[model samples]
Target: MGDFAEAVRERVRRAREAVAAAHEAGDVYAVAEAREELDDALRMARDLGVDPGAGPEDEHEDPR
Candidate 1:
């Protein structure tokens, strides 16, 4: 479980860094790729038990 969390964190961090670099380089395609990678990491995190939705306090709000 801990290993999975660490992997997800690492992937997310790398994706964010890539996005920053892409922005600095003015590469729109790269930015889009990074965003996709970040989304994938988020999905993996959710699969590993991380809630990818609003918490109890935010339940009243529509998720969609």
Candidate 2:
């Protein structure tokens, strides 16, 4: 991947982590904000053809 796509992928990864952390902290506001950021990151990935389908959540998912 080029630099732009790689950067977007990193942003998406960070956004996912932020969302998980916000949920873990039990902060509704932070969770909402993180969700927004994640959404934005995903949108950017789609716009840039960065293949947003696979993410952290997929890491632990079963192949089946």
Candidate 3:
């Protein structure tokens, strides 16, 4: 359980970094790809009985 959680967290962190880099580069396609990756990570978290909205960024904003 701990290892799985760590993997999920790592994926989320990478996806976020990709999104930021894509946005900085002004690459729409890359941004979309990164968003998809982020979504997938969030879904994984949900499947593990975790709340996707539990992240700090999620606290102040609605994903949709």
Candidate 4:
């Protein structure tokens, strides 16, 4: 993977870890915030030119 991909992956991994820790500590808000961070990382990946899958048009359609 390129630098951008690696950076996004690291962000996602850290967010997952944060969520797990927050869950164990019973912090709902922290978990939600971590999830939001993960979502931002995904957006960053897309902005960095990563093709995750089909675009919005395919959301309601089945891909074979």
Candidate with top TM-score is 2
Candidate 3 residue runs with Cα over 4 Å from true position: 50-64
Model 3: per-residue lDDT, tens digit, 1-64?
Answer: 7777877878877777787788778888988898898889888887896544445246654222
- Candidate maximizing lDDT: 2
Clash number by candidate, in order:
0, 0, 0, 0
TM-score of each: 0.70, 0.80, 0.76, 0.63
Candidate 2 residue runs with Cα over 4 Å from true position: 56-64
Residue 53, candidate 3: how far off, in angstroms?
8.3
Whole-model lDDT per candidate: 0.65, 0.79, 0.73, 0.64
lDDT of 1 by residue, 1-64 (tens): 6676777777766776776677778888987897688678767867787643432213443111
Tens digit of per-residue lDDT, candidate 2, span 1-64: 6888888988998898888888778888988898899889999888877886686555763212
Candidate 4 ranges with C-alpha deviation above 4 Å: 47-64
**Candidate 3 clashing pairs?**
none
Better of 1 and 4 by TM-score: 1
lDDT of 4: 0.64
Model 3 collision count: 0
Report the C-alpha lDDT of model 4 over 1-64, residue by residue, as the tens digit.
Answer: 6776777767766765676677777888987897687668667767887644433223543111
